[model samples]
Target: MSDWAYSDVVPWWPYVFILLGGWLPTDVWRYIGVVSASRIDETGEAATIARTIATSLVAAVIAQLVFYPSGALADIPTWVRVVALCIGFAAYQLSRRKILAGIFAAEIVIGIWALAPGLG
Candidate 1:
């Protein structure tokens, strides 16, 4: 075996291609968003769809964390995570749906939970 991880290496050009390949897909969409946003109405169906998609993505991430946690979070009990989520959601709603408040509440709960006697 050589000092490299792979037997074959294509050098600089291939690395540049790989970088562009990873960036172009998302970059193209961002440019499209910039162009379309100038004509898109804030209250239109497209805006609603975008908001719904964003909300769904966030919900999916939360679900993933609760159902299949990783790293240090995996050590905490699932019920505790769910309870923290609930408290965060409630605090969010109570604070007129403020995102930061909800995040802070959830983080505080999780931090305390991590400090619990039997937890890590």
Candidate 2:
């Protein structure tokens, strides 16, 4: 059984691992959060701290992706990424901090950069 789990004899083994190892663990937490959400106080200090931490983590991830990217993103020049970030931030600010607007603006810039010849 262990050998079969590691071998390619079962093509769907990896999918089973993904469902068990990845999805199930996260889904448990999501279900718990959903069940307990009504008990959370939105205006409480704990909530405020959670929000701050979440925002900081997101910002850190963005910074890491832009400054030290891997894989396909690494192929794009740093200047292009910075320009896209700037445009996206400006769009977000101008659109009253709409996240989709910022994301769309950044995507448009990156798409253009990828498509245009001699731009990268």
Candidate 3:
């Protein structure tokens, strides 16, 4: 933003380095997951529990974003988000558990809602 934050103060490659620094931890987990999977049983109860927990965590995040969102999402009516999510869930279940169908339906609904002139 200023000369004080230039190459002399913050260095020329700080942004590049910072980007790599943030990615390192994610890569570490990816490598660990690959290594661990080879050693663990795929059908084991612990693995099942871990997968369930991960799914629950993701679902919780999706619910929170739909119910109590922030930033631009906070601008959209709560009712819209709720209705979209409900449609998505029903689509997901009705499509014989097809995840992509649910995602597509939900996204299409949101896009249509966002495009409606009266929304503003």
The candidate maximizing lDDT is 2
lDDT of each: 0.87, 0.95, 0.87
Better of 1 and 2 by TM-score: 2
Provide TM-scores for the models: 0.76, 0.78, 0.75
Cα lDDT tens digits, model 3, 26-68, are 8999999988888888799999999999999998999899988
Candidate 1 local lDDT, residue 37: 82
Ranking by lDDT: 2, 3, 1
Summarize candidate 2's per-residue lDDT along 75-119 as a digit string, tens digits: 999999999999999999999999999999999999999999999
By summed lDDT, which 10 consecutive residues of candidate 1 come out lowest?
5-14
TM for candidate 1 is 0.76
lDDT score at residue 24, model 2, on the 0-100 scale: 100
Best by TM-score: 2
